[model samples]
Target: MSTRTLPPPPPPAEVRCWPDREALLADRAKAMAELHRLSIGVPRLLLLWLLACGLAVGWGLVGAALKTFEESRPDALSALFGVIFACTAAGFLIPTGIVMGLGVRRDKTVRERLTQWSSLDRDPTNDARFRSPGVSLCWFVPSFLLCTLGLWLSFATPATAERGQETYADVTMLMGLGLILWLTGLLGIAKAVSHFRWAVRLVTAVPVSAGDGGHR
Candidate 1:
């Protein structure tokens, strides 16, 4: 992952001063695009995590099938289960691995773009730093409710044979946690996207710099 930070903004007074919108809009658009590029990695990381969970589930199903076969005799159904589990695992793992790997590769490119855009002499928008507290609350509200319901169901439901005698409570707990984490990650990515949109609007609204200007 790229560890570089964006350069700091100019003085407060300069930030208050607006430049020529007509002249700076094009350059601002380019800079906004670059900023947008920097925000994709976190979402890709989240997706990778999701796929890993799927792989784990598939592996568990396969293990159950194997255990069943060893305890008794291999049946057509058992073989089918094993095959299905293998395919499911591969289905989740392969494409996700590829996409996440691509995201890693693109991280450097995004950082480089940010560096190039930083040379412009404009104050940075508070887009990334300026999220409303209510925004986070809104995201967490659904997550909390879902987690609560999931816990109730996990405890209420019985364990299935496919789960190898594991309690529904146990499995549900694991799944619920995974869901929470995934949702949290999605929230992060969404915030990053929102920041980009806010940056675009901020750029449009801010006064254009006469001598030099940069964008968020």
Candidate 2:
């Protein structure tokens, strides 16, 4: 029987420990804590902002619907509506357009912010504990439905009030459209924020237990 000697198994590869990566990951929890601190005041600020927009839409809808400026002056309210809607649409589209326009700027910001934290790095592990991506879809769905309904209601009727004509439908539609956009905008903002927050958590993560026995 020939004893076969396998070349002494290649010297076990040297193990390398990446303490910096680990340290960064551990520090990510601090990012969440900082975010929490920021959110404490942010929620109320957001709430107030929301309340103000609601009031604007509410008052505008009431004013437009109750007042027959559109009907009384065929060219008047229609023109006013066009102007206001155009301005509002422009306002939203402008900033978003600018951000999206310079594609590099936005992407860079997202990538950089995700990797870094103003106060601490993002924790990759902690990100897993939060919500799923599909979570965002919930917020936009309502905006789509409401906006659709609002649009339908707005155009179905005549602007002028006559023996049987009413412009309330149009007014309601405008308001609904405004609200839909407003709410959807909020959802979009939230989604963007979440992405970066998650990104921060992701960048600072290191797989301590990857392949065989590793530093956990």
Candidate 3:
């Protein structure tokens, strides 16, 4: 007589399909590509903002230089200045704001989704490096803070005549710095989105014990 032992049965099919890298990658790539494409326009938006700032400064200088023209026909000069300001806002500032807004929204959405997916295997201790904040935040936060301070200074009543002039100059400088910071932030965001596309590719390409659930 002989005794024989049979091997245990394999695990159920459904148990092997929870974390499918290929399928996750395919979905994530589609979402991220759309966002990355939008980010490409961010630098262009920054350039437009800078151009608008330059044009505004030039317009102010022209007005200041033509004091006689401004004093003689104050109403007409005011109207002309208004038109130029309106045109700049409509043609450049508004469009740039819209693009940046959309990019920010899309970036937030895609990053959140990816974070959720990555959490399945992400190590808790790696949060500082791997789960860091977006690059744009580094510049955007400080820029807005400076901008707010500049605006407040512009409105605040000065305690002395000499202080008023200094305050005005300080406000102008702070606003200018804010604009530069904003541009830097926008550029950083564009690069970050581009980098995210590659990260998505790498994550999806990783080898996992669980299959891609029939996704190629």
Candidate 4:
């Protein structure tokens, strides 16, 4: 990580003697783009999460086909239930392992992004720091809850096939949680993008001027 810092702003009196929109916008664009890049890591995380989810769903489909409840061939169904249970476990596990493995490839990228963000010049572009303290809280709370619930359900897979039967309740529980996490993340991204765009407007639209005979 680079310990570099952005050059500080000029003296208060000098900056206050201001005028042009174009110059202000240029400065605002530069700052916002940097912050925008820092947030890029978020999408990679999301993609990995979604892929894991898809893998889980694929197993669930296989499980559904093999289930034996309310059928005459109970023995065959029981054997099938064992197979289905095993499949489900393998399904979610593969994606999870892949994501964790991604930690190695993604760590340095994320770290560098954060490092650059730390060096940004303080300005309205930094509004993400303050915007939506409440929204941030709201997003995380549900995300945490759903993900936890999903993991709990996932761990109950073997039990789902005990005593020559299968119950879909646990599978449903996991699906519900996975859906919740997906929705929460999507909503968070939408809201964040909107808020960021608005802040950029406010910053660049504001004026910055130089008094007569000014030189950079």
Candidate 5:
């Protein structure tokens, strides 16, 4: 009286049929360009600038608190202010750090998943819009200038203090601001380079035919 168990039906296969090779290439190029645009869009850039500014301000606050502690005899008001500054700095820094760490992790995971999902089929550089010089230069100039300015500020002697009168707290604030700027600029430069390289690669790459397993 035992009943036979039937196996579950196999999942249905999903297929995308393109009208022609040109249609498929156009679709792929559009997708790749869109991804590039999203990566360096204005909203993302603004967020990065805000994050850098927050870190810089947090570090400055920490420096101020440390300066108060270095005073031989800080008054009650000064000490209270120092504590407040420290607490505020911690509030800003902790959340900023967490957001940055989480963003990096999420971006990595998304990129890995995307790599597994599909691949390029044709040279996207064939499209004039995709290989526009304006796009790369717009990113490069600002990034290069920021990097240069940051380096100069980091090494230049502080004008506020005489050579022998500089305090550790002052130095800490200057260095922290400079470091954040340097890192931000470097990130921008990397993005610009990546964009340039992608354009170049696309231009030189051979277009794959749909029959040759061009996309997966």
Candidate 6:
């Protein structure tokens, strides 16, 4: 019988140590900034805006179709146009939303992996700097504004046929826009709250010796 031999096991992964705690913190900050930039770049924002527009258009078309069907003499041409517009809008919005959501998830995973590799146990000073008031304010102000504006729009009374010249279709369009704004604003608010909580935790965390930073 021939003896079977297995190849040697791979060596254990090496842990990189920073010369000091400050160096480690600096590296962490830089990495985080880069990650943020990549996650919310201008292109991504533009794409989201476009998708939002598409959704609004879709809703408007759907409302128009409803109005047409309610009419005593509904035309086949208008119905066809409405169907085309709605399908187009859905074709753009659904796939784009899915792609963007997946992209966000992937970015989050990357951030977590990087943090695990580069984090230190105890560094209050560094943590404070990372979650500075300036940074927190930047996040908070926009989120607050979005939430406020969104809520106002969402709850505003829709124009009624008895009260105004606006048709049912017009009211429906306005309501759809408000709903989109509310959802977007809600998401922003959630993100801001999460950041605030993270800052508070960092401020209150206990400190210990961050001895020669090695494999986190």
Top-TM-score candidate index: 5
Q: Which scores greater on TM-score, model 2 or model 6?
A: 6
Q: How accurate is candidate 3 locally (lDDT)?
A: 0.43
Cα deviation at 160, candidate 2, in Å, is 12
Query: 1-216, model 2: which lDDT tens digit per residue?
Result: 111211111112245343564654444445444443333233423543454355445445545544545455667757577556555545554554343334324334433433344223333456654333444344334435544554554454334334445445454545555554554455445544655465454555554333433322
Q: Which candidate has the highest lDDT of all? A: 5
Per-residue lDDT over 173-197 for candidate 4, one digit per residue giving the tens place of the 0 to 100 score: 4554455455435544443454455
- Over the full model, what C-alpha lDDT does candidate 1 score relative to the true structure? 0.48
Find the 10 residues in a row with the least total lDDT in model 4.
Answer: 206-215
> Sorted by TM-score, highest first, which candidate order results?
5, 6, 1, 2, 4, 3
lDDT tens digits by residue: candidate 3, 66-174: 4333344558766576556545545544554565565556545554444434433322332233322354354345445544554444344242325435544344434
The window of 10 residues in a row where model 5 has the poorest summed lDDT is 1-10
53-93: candidate 6 lDDT, tens digit per residue = 66666666666655665552467886777677667657766
Q: After superposition, how far is residue 16 of candidate 3 from its true place, in Å?
A: 9.0
Per-residue alpha-carbon lDDT of candidate 5 for residues 14-46, written as tens digits (9 for 90 to 100): 344565666666665555455444555555566
N/CA/C clash count, model 3: 0
Off by over 4 Å in 6: 1-27, 38-51, 64-73, 103-119, 122-129, 132-139, 158-167, 207-216
Pitting candidate 2 against candidate 3, the one with the higher TM-score is: 2
Number of colliding residue pairs in each model = 5, 5, 0, 3, 0, 0
Question: Model 4, which residues run further than 4 Å from truth?
Answer: 1-49, 61-104, 124-135, 155-161, 167-216
| Candidate 5 TM-score over all chains jointly | 0.74
* Regions of model 1 farther than 4 Å from truth: 1-25, 34-73, 123-216
- Tell me each candidate's TM-score: 0.42, 0.39, 0.38, 0.38, 0.74, 0.64
> Which segments of candidate 2 are over 4 A away from where they belong?
1-19, 32-49, 52-58, 61-115, 118-124, 131-138, 150-164, 168-216
**Candidate number with the higher lDDT (4 or 5):** 5
Better of 2 and 5 by TM-score: 5
* Better-scoring candidate (TM-score), 1 or 5: 5
